[model samples]
Target: MVTPFQVHVHLRRHLMKELPETDDAVAQWCRDQFVVKDGLLDKHALEDTFSDKELQEIRRPVKSLLVVTSWAILVSLGALKFLHWSALLSSWKGIALSAIGLAVVTVLMQILIRFSQSERSTPAKVAPAKPKNGGEPSETRQNKEQ
Candidate 1:
């Protein structure tokens, strides 16, 4: 949901000039340690390396604006399509309500996006094995006993 402007501003503010190569040795180092090395290394063990402060700072307003603007555009256009502009002007309450409805919808969609991504990823595949005790021994164990 990050907009181009927010991304550009963040990079410029942080003085980030270029992206790191995926296979770079430094990338591996950062995986176990902090990529930024802003004295936050080794804080999170194997978990995502994102900082909540940075995340909230960046994500909050960026996400909000994206929602708000998209809402504004979509609602305005949809309203214009569904109802006459003159009619909307006559009923100020209806126009205001539609705007509110669009804002609520935008927020709801953002929440759902966050939750869906946070859901646990599917586990890796594993081969099936014989039951432990179904009145029969595993083939390997039976062979070893013989």
Candidate 2:
């Protein structure tokens, strides 16, 4: 339920905390980035200060690690299969079972990646109920009266 603005502030604070050891000037700069004016976040100023370059820098190592880990896992599995053919391919024929396992894993990964993206902040719109007497919903009627 965390809002985007909350995320922005939290990230700013986290960076400010972490930046001091690397460079005091950068830490001070991050602290100055999220100054709120007139009770609203200065979003443009925030974006200007903490640009996408910083985000990309953070993501680069993690992505590289993931790619390397995925390759290592695949290689290990291949090695295991080569070492123990009977154990890996005992039941349900041979290639068919492997193909099915690969297909299932691929489909599940696709589903997981698709759903992991950020969701819409707005609530879903619901169709107003059909009035018993063919009129607006009672909530709307009450609001109009007020």
| Cα misplacement distance, residue 22 of candidate 1 (Å) | 27
> For residues 1-146, could you state the per-residue lDDT of candidate 1 as single tens digits?
87665231222133234445544655775574444554444444344443454543434667888899999999889868776745654577977977788799999999999987966779989877546566466786777779
Candidate 1 error regions (>4 Å):
1-78, 119-146
lDDT measured at residue 110 in model 2 versus the true structure, 0 to 100: 97
Q: Which segments of candidate 2 are over 4 A away from where they belong? A: 1-59, 62-67, 70-75, 82-92, 120-146
**Candidate-wise lDDT, in order:** 0.63, 0.65
Residues 18-95, candidate 2: write the lDDT tens digits: 555644677675566545332234454555444344442234677888999999999999868774865656655665
